[model samples]
Target: MATFSTRYSRLRDNVEEEPNSSAFDEIIMKQEQIIRDQDEDLELVGRSVNTLKHMSTKIGDELNEQAVMLDDLGNEMDTVDSKLNNVMKKIAKLTHMDDGKCTCSQT
Candidate 1:
């Protein structure tokens, strides 16, 4: 029977001299490169997400500012409309006033 150390050594030498060993090494290297590329892609995606979040916040702020401005403009228009209505009423009253008696003569 082969000794344990002899069997282990035979197995190790066989693995080292195997025809496909280089092919396995090449596959491992390719896998490692793929993982590194994926990591870089994930980092870029994270940065893009953060940038989008900041832009969304700015847009929301601008929308709120515009809403406040529109409300102020609406209030100013209401005030102007009320003043105009009052003036129209005063004009109508003046137009309804009686005119002094007038006589016309023809020769």
Candidate 2:
């Protein structure tokens, strides 16, 4: 029992004399640098997300404007088609009256 107690006291004294090992301090410093690098990477990712959001908004606005313009163009095409149909009807009426006959008199 005395030998065991002496060995325990010697171990305790050695542990107390060297509280902070050089290897342990280096490991802690490396961990802190890693944490700082991770924080910077997260900030950059957040900025990239914001930039993408802004670009998406701009693209959506442009697409909406294009849709409106296409709608206006469709309306204009309908108007032109109606006008052409009217002109065709008038031509058909005149052709029916003529019936391949010349009604001009010699003066």
Candidate 3:
């Protein structure tokens, strides 16, 4: 039977000249399980990042659309303001004409 220290040394180093097979196999299995768990964690993080990226893109698109709509509304309001100014000018001219006209005198 191998000494306790010899068995411990074999377990610690994977490149042992005379590996105790059961201990090596156990170590490999545990290491594989740890690697799998790490892979799963990395995959979860990747998915989360992708989701956030998509949401950010969506938000940016919506903001762009809103800005365009605001620009259009501003342009339309300017047109309406110009038309209103013309109507006011016409009304002022009509008022001046009325003031100059003589009132109908009763016979």
Candidate 4:
């Protein structure tokens, strides 16, 4: 009876002192879940960054087109100014001629 009691006590101690592997597995699963959430957030941020870059490029293109149109308008305005100056000069000459200061010798 004493031998049996000692043997049972030793076996109980060995089984009771075993490491809890389920605790480690639970910790590992929690860490994996956190990593998956972080990955999803990173993907969403990457997509938002790409969208902003595309919009910026589109705005730049539109500004460039507007700049070209402004240049064309400036050139047309210069041509109109030259034509107006020529017309003014002709009108001044005609007005002076009508003022009886005509330089024609066959009057």
How far residue 40's Cα lies from its native spot in candidate 1, in Å, is 1.2
Error of 4 at 23 (Å): 2.8
**Could you tell me the lDDT of residue 104 within candidate 4?**
39
* Cα-based TM-score, every candidate: 0.67, 0.67, 0.57, 0.64
In model 2, the runs with Cα more than 4 Å from the true position are 1-19, 102-107
Candidate 4: stretches off by over 4 Å: 1-19, 98-107
lDDT of each residue in 49-106, candidate 2, tens digit only: 9999999999999999999999999999999999999999987776566567535435
Stretches of candidate 3 above 4 Å error? 1-28, 96-107
Which numbered prediction scores highest in TM-score against the true structure? 2
Tell me which of candidates 3 and 4 scores higher on TM-score.
4
lDDT of candidate 3 over 1-107, digit per residue (tens) = 87565434345554767768898999999999999999999999999999999999999999999999999999999999999999999777766676596444358
- The lDDT per prediction is 0.87, 0.87, 0.89, 0.89
Question: Candidates ranked by TM-score, best first?
Answer: 2, 1, 4, 3
Clashing pairs in 4: none
Q: On a 0 to 1 TM-score scale, where does candidate 2 land against the true structure?
A: 0.67
Worst 10 residues of 3 by lDDT: 5-14
Candidate 1 vs 3: which has more TM-score: 1
Indicate the worst ten consecutive residues by lDDT in candidate 1.
Answer: 5-14
